[model samples]
Target: MTRTLVVVGHGMTGHRLAERLRALDTSGAWRIVVLAEEAHPAYDRIRLSSYLTGGSRQDLALAGRDFTEDPRVDLRLGCAVVSGDRAERTVRTADGEQLPYDALVLATGSEPFVPPVPGRDLANCFVYRTFDDLDAIRGAARRGRPCVVVGGGLLGLEAAHALRLLGMRPHVVESASHLMPTQLDAGAARVLHRSATGLGLRLHCGTAVASIEAGPDGAVRAVVLGDATVLESDLVVFAAGIRPRDELAAALGLERGERGGVLVDENCRTADEHIWAVGECAAVQGRCYGLVAPGYGMAETVAGRLAGRSPRPFDGTDTSTSLKLLGVHVATFGIIHPRGGPAAEAVFAEGTTRYAKVFLEPESGRLLGGILAGETGSRTALGPFVGHRPPADLEQLLLP
Candidate 1:
């Protein structure tokens, strides 16, 4: 019997899995079927912010515009997998079609977490995640009016900058005291705040909107904060966070995290045999990796195993990351939070801007983790450190 693989999701992870499986397993026995919920093929969701600016929909293309010929891969577009039956090895789609497969992969990626604030349903209110999302924002910007973004993380800042490119000075509100609080250390966050402010983007930190007030006609006019302060707004885009689309998994009786992410083993396999999941939807070792690199790694590992090759198990990935904050560079890695006090040795700190602190076992001096900022040199040095590869002199790596 010929083995068939059905991948549910046309996102980045699903597309990569299809490409890798075909490349890794050259045997002509397996067939690939990819299901896309949207009419368009997979597009680069990472650059959705860029699409907010004046960019064509094709600019965010994840895969080619068309899929045709050769091994005869089947692509079901504009149809969503409503749920699945693991016992029968089948998935029910929105269009009432059942797809049967020997192996199933769930790449059901995340969606923009829309806050529950009032007036979020206004015509001017939106979420920036897909090409359609950007197109909507771009159309709104044609009115040449200011818009407010309700988060200060990477995507939110990028969205705000894209709005500036849309010819509007954007207001960015962060519930946290610092911007990019997860990715950057305090110092780096400060620098990013300065850069964002310098770029003329209004920064509102340590305050959150309690509700969005609207005109009598039911259009957004202002955002009312918890402190009873209200700021006028013509438009609002909420980039607060993302939640995994795991209802399908749960409906199928698959284990999932408290936050609704699919629970997968270190190798990206769920409790059910022959059912694998990856990408932001999978939470392994009690951590959900929202980064692309680890998702790509998980796809490769699963692909490797399907081909009868030895694939390595996945430990949780290091949360270290660096990125441009509205044009300013900021980076952080390792055990940033205060763990074992005085025992954790001070690794590096240069003039309050460049700093590195590590938490060692005190006896072993083994580099457990550390945080880096203000120094671009630390970017390359992070990979080996977080992976616990080898103890390279981080001080030497920092110095000229």
Candidate 2:
């Protein structure tokens, strides 16, 4: 008997789920089809900034030409899921074709969130999310126009650095008191602030764009702030935040979370038996994990279970993360701030052009999680210690 596996959204989780399902179900001859909304093949979105700076286009692809050109898997590019019929077990594409599936998986991913503000519809405004977005940025940068990145978080900082690389003065506007507020402690944010400012990218902490007004012909000329001041700029990019893509899932009558994610069990199964969801689109136990690692874990678990292989339940995700921002390496795992009294303590080390900090629980002194900025050669060896339930004493790794 032949089984048809249709994966909507050919991003990281969708491609992974399809490949793993086929590998696990060796007995079932299966046909796989992947529909991607973007015209490009699955690429490394995490490194999009690198491409924005100077990285080659060919380097961004996670999957080579072989995968897209392969005959076994039908890769449908530039296709969007307009609708889905759960009762009929079929998905309608933007085109006239309605594809039938014995089993379905949705991994539509997310979109960059730009809040409603005055003059937002003006020209020279953009969001940093897709390859097309980066290409537009590249075109703007070649003309050496001053760039303003609205939002001082990870992606925003990266965009600022990329703009600086293109020989344009880049400014960052963060509504928070410091940069990387959600990821780094106050002190760590200060260190990053100094580092970024020293590199010539202006930092406006504790403030944001009140409005974006156009000049003579509807081209962005200045970013107006609430403080009654305007920052001169010709280009603006928004890396503010992202919201999960679950509009299609919601129309299917499947249970969804308040944050607009399809509610799924540990095994990534929705209300229907033959249906599953994974990646950023899934809300497991009323929570949506925006990270890639947890999304891949969900894909692995669901694929295993569908193939009649027993797998461990999908536990709630950890908030641990490690990444580089504007050439600064940072990593954190466990809880940086513990709940009880004196449970969390921060230990830090300083070197030439580098900073590292670890937060540990008092009694356990285990690695609750920490951040490394500037260089991360050591965190590769240090991650296992934090990965192992914070260890017995958090002070040991920092001191010895």
What TM-score does each of the candidates earn? Answer: 0.90, 0.90
- Global lDDT of each model? 0.76, 0.78
Best by lDDT: 2
lDDT of 1 by residue, 251-280 (tens): 899888876788888998988878988888
To one decimal, what is the Cα RMSD in angstroms of model 2 from the true structure? 2.9
Worst 10 residues of 2 by lDDT: 391-400
Query: Local error of candidate 2 at 41, Å?
Result: 1.5
Candidate 2: C-alpha lDDT: 0.78
How would you encode candidate 2's per-residue C-alpha lDDT over 13-79 as one tens digit per residue?
A: 8877877876787776667788999997677777888888778767977666666665557888999
The Cα RMSD of model 1 versus the native structure comes to: 2.8
Task: Let me know the TM-score candidate 1 reaches against the reference structure.
Answer: 0.90
